[model samples]
Target: MLLLNNHTMKSKIEKSTFIVKLTAVLVVLMISIISCNKELTDRKDFSNNTGGNVIDAQQQKVLYVIVDGARGESVFKSSTPNLSKMIKNGMFTINAVSDENGLSATSWADMLTGVDKTKHKVISEDFSNNKLTDYPMFFKRVKDNTSLRTAAFSISPALSTKLVTHADVNTSLPNDEAVKTATLAELANNNAAVVLAEFQGVDKAGAQYGYDASVPQYAAAITNIDTYIGELNTAIKARPNFSKENWLIVIASNKGGDYPVIPALMDQTLYSKPLLNGFVILYNPNFKSTIYNKPANLNSLPYLGSYGKLNGDTIASVDAAKSNLYNFGTTGEYTVEFKLKVQSFGTLNAPIFFKTSSPANAATGWWIIHNGSNGTWRLGGLASAAISTPTTKAMEVNQWYNIGFKIYFVGTVRYVQLYQDGDPIGSPTVITGRTVNNSEPLVAGYRSGFGNSATQFITDIRIFNAAVPDAVIKDFACQVLLDSRHPNYNNLIGYWPALDGAGTLIKDQSKSKNDFVFQKSTQWLSFEDYDNKFCIKPTPELYKIVPRGIDIPRFILGWLNINATGFNLDGKVWTPIYTNILK
Candidate 1:
């Protein structure tokens, strides 16, 4: 299945590219014909230029229903006849979480765009903070393809205005009833093919009362919404052509309650994932409620050794003088690398790894910090010393990333470049501040004197006096690193392979023998790559998905390297697809 091998992939992309250009020509001719001498019928053609240029019917149209702050437990166990029936008859997941942490804006944007906050650039609720033009919603996607698509958005007035750009009908109302009423009108009167109806009552309940099942207001909110869900389903079934049309009803929540994922982390108890704990229900006539169990392929690594466990500020402490970080002189040319798996982000701005004596005194030191304001990695440190060319997105929990930095000097101008999986994030960045040369023990995991605690698993740490070559880094990111016997091992100042789970100390394999012994006095857990593996298949067929109207079969996008010239502006699907209605 996959055309992943270089030869077949290249040729397929070329073929698809040509087909898209040819179809664009066909679409244009059809459009010209439709424009001239179109019978000016009295029927309100809700059709706009934004409607899909290549209109055709797919197996099903979508009705996206979102209930804010509805927890999985509340929704699944609530006494709701209609939702219960739908769940029993539908393909659903009760353990689903918002794609990003439970932030409403980021969650909805990601769901709508089928991408993450990194791609969509929506970190918060403010519409101005979004970059939706580059990453658009699915409705806009359908509309761009053909006019056979008609969409309606019945949403909360206070929250979203930018979600709809090409929809034929957009309504904003005060309450769920008003939103339901508008949605009903669209379903009954208008031939809208796709719809999004969002209600915020459950979230309001959680914000007002508590998020637990025992909370009366929260329970009441769920009960009331269940009634409204029944009404909406009834309206859809009552459609004139309901028998002919295939409809897919999707019910999901953006997030759960306001409780922080990790209130005050300590031990493994302090560790918690970014789980939103919401439900997803997909209902259609031809579907049965079933669950698929598979390995967690959240982009993991082959576990080679026991990871460094840090609870509170407790580190695998080496004597101050023995630290490679401490012994390095004024020369800033070196590479520090580790395979990192974030189990918990204790508090915002807590350091993952830093060599500085104090965070405030970080004017002379460098850090790889979590910048919460933007939910991204801050490569430089303090103020002007950090990378100026915009940082990359923050690390997601429960995934493995080979993260590190190359601190090198150019004519005494210190530049520290950040790398993930061997590629540069921005550019070779400059850190104007020089190292303070402190005996901070080259702190890994959590730094000292930080109130907020964090949980992480790190291994295969290497502080090379010379930067590791890009090829070596890329090929062996998760593999066993260079040892003392290797030719290039002399460049290494400190190397902790973290091999062998049972040990009194983590040995520095690269000649120095500066090992750190256990101080926490507990079980040394073996390394296991507990990463979440989603969409890990190499088969190209698995990635195929036709945009609603595109006549061409869904083809692999990533491996084939098909450009947007063969697709819509966002490269979602091949555009100018063959269809008669475009004209």
Candidate 2:
């Protein structure tokens, strides 16, 4: 009976082992099938949109216009009839803000490459490095993919020289008259995919003369560009191909100049304003919606856990582990909640603050909210409170605190409400007496009251179009932080860079410039001998005299020792011209 029982156990164990092996094989097969399916799906999606091995349909006719040194306010004020019509029909970002540096090469390069200057490495005018050729430009990438024709006409020498190099046909014209002629010719050809025209006479005039003198020229240039744009539109409307083919017209600026130096005109703070510097217009006949939100928009209240150390120079250290949601809808309400997992509590305790680009125009206007970590919240204009304290009792490190706030726009006025955890901290803070409306970008983070490093780990950031109720906020907080059962609980978007292969620098072996340089073989040939054989040339007389119709130089013959027992000057061992030899 014992022997029979032992045999039965052994048989069950064998069956279990077989089942495990089968399961492993099935899992591998499933994974392989899923991967193949994903590839097929991607291919199908691309084919449906791009016409399956055909070129991009929308790139058939594209017009790009750059208005050099036109301020955002000036763009709005000026009577650009054609541009106005485009704006009315197309989409525009009223509160668009650029980098703080305002360098022309940097911004223009950003627009063309779709990458910021931080990545492109094109910072200033004096940057003359050949590194710009390392990354493919927009035109270069598009040109490689399609057979579309391209052209550019520009007034600014810098724009004409640097930006136009990637295009197929480019003309560096000085004025609008020349630009109009070139543009008309390119449009008439019916083969142009992109026609870019840049007008810079206004900026040039401003630099030479005063701002007042340049204003008229700027206006005249605008009028001319508008008239020509209208003419082009009319021409396109007349063409039968316009209905069938897709086209996009983009108008923008490189940078805006100051009026104080050029002319003692109205002291319009172009530098202080955000959107005043530049704007982008997208005109597509097939455009379904005028406004298309960028994939990763700026969060209404972006949180920076540790924004630089107390004495450090770093402005803010963003937590790449947190979800940053950018709201694209116009002038709505938003709320952000974050838990501060304090490691150590010390003096200099203050509530987390909120800031926006409203008061100081798009360039400035950093409004703030006070002591958001605690129950009491304060909302004030830029730089109103001290973040440091002598006592360490207020903030105890290693303690967790909940902070949240609400921001809503009432017509042109924006209101703020502060909350600590689930409780309302104080009265609704109203920022009033504004010359302008709420058309600025919003940012949020911890403030030391002064400039101090915010050393706190924040989690559970949520944004809403309308005001979120206390119950919903509590549920979201519990779902994300307490219970950890939120659908997107891991903040997956924040960690996407690691998954999608973006955070790491991928080495491209196909790029010849990036290929490894192997050391020259020292055994085969010395550097001096290689140079002499390749760099030195034989005389015509020496070239004509050889056994196998090959040249045998006297110097080389002496060096080679033709008289030696092993040496011969026949077909087997004839002196060959190094220049004629290909490596």
Candidate 3:
């Protein structure tokens, strides 16, 4: 009976194992089928819009479409079969930016003249003080080189009247439909070398509703324009000589629309600004697919946590055996540095970091305070509230800054100097009769009646036992992570990265092990590592290299094999593919 039972159990176990293996195989097969279906769907879509394979002997023609106020990300997210087809077949970038000036005329001038707003000066909608005559429209450049006819049809009358110079046929229409009709007719009958059609309905829809894909009207408007684009493609294909023509179809948006503040888009970089976002698609059947993404932000710090507003919120050091190592006496030289972001500057002096529990006039502690009235910070000693001169550059609100102070002596003359980023904020001041040594734990923030709702963020607090050299201070002030490369790495008495994603205690990575204990619950915040160097907006020079509205003219000129050498255009050509096509 026992032998029979054992044989039966082994058989049951084998059957169970076989069932489990079968289930696993079925799940993998289902996943593989789903993935293959998606790939096949994509391939089918691409095949339907191939526009025929490229022919080496085909004539090169240009068709550029401009959709006003269409945010790049929104357009990418929208369901547009026509745009998607082109995107899969050619070079594209949803991360393209508009003009830094953020005006329609500024963008138009950049697109037509191959230069930035600083050169063309078309800063407003009215086109009051523009230097377009010096850097005339690309149509004029094309006309000067070759006798090829160029035409432009714009929904905005101002574009035709003020900006569309040197065109063989410049027609100003009232609506997108009319502009599309005119452009289609021009493409059908005329042998135009370059054709430009500007549609304004997208911008109008965005202005009324919103600029996001979630907004029905905005998405519908983009889709409607996508249908018009499909019709235009059909017209181009219907041309009698279409089989012998190589069309470079370019589609882009002038700028993105402004909307309510979105927390997700609040990355501390120019790319975070909605008004600066746009799209660019340079399509040709012969071109290989090349999609550009947002450039990697080289100089950015990861935002980890938010303890609270600086009004009364404080993160103090725990009472450890080596807590007194941070106390810098009048005779002892030391450096205290941290990253700060002030939300608002109130009337009262903001005490960023101090060693004393009660920091007052003639107190035996040193402190760094920001004067709200003059927009400058000063190093304070015990005898007086301020020791060093006020910084020339006032600290701006809602911006990340690396600020600290160094206390050193010049042959018995103890001096305190305030530093911003890696450079000195103001001239050093002589410290006369002040002792910064105290028994109280080193405090990061304190209650100064800074005003209701006046808050600040503090992190990456580093306190050194010795005064670091100026070069060393400058080198590591903007550094996000603490490493052994620092010359004063061994002199670090207290170092709190404050990046512990959770918990009330901020662990100190230094050898002293003096941790910071938050008084209240940890209020943590997160951020994408954005380039703080170009926090708000990139300079026009930086925008020149990226895919922007300004590059459209230069790109067109390159496609036409025209040498824009002496044009002195600020915009550079984005030659991703077809390098041999450009002169």
Better of 1 and 2 by lDDT: 1
| Candidate 1: tens digits of C-alpha lDDT, residues 230-295 | 888898889877766656677777767754333443112101222365666756554445432222
Q: Which digits, one per residue and each the tens of the lDDT, describe model 3 over residues 143-241?
A: 887777889999888888999998889988989999999998998974856899999998999999998888999999999999999999889989999
lDDT of 2 by residue, 484-581 (tens): 34333332221110011121121111111121111211111111111110111222222122111111111112211212222222111222111111
Residue 261 of candidate 2: its Cα lDDT? 42
Off by over 4 Å in 2: 1-59, 205-220, 259-271, 274-276, 288-583
Give the best candidate by lDDT.
Answer: 3
Identify the leading candidate in terms of TM-score.
3
lDDT (Cα, 0-100) at 198 in candidate 2: 74
- lDDT per model vs. reference: 0.59, 0.45, 0.74
lDDT of 2: 0.45
Candidate that beats the other on lDDT, 1 or 3, i.e. the better one = 3
- Supply candidate 3's per-residue lDDT for 462: 88
* Candidate no. 2 TM-score: 0.42
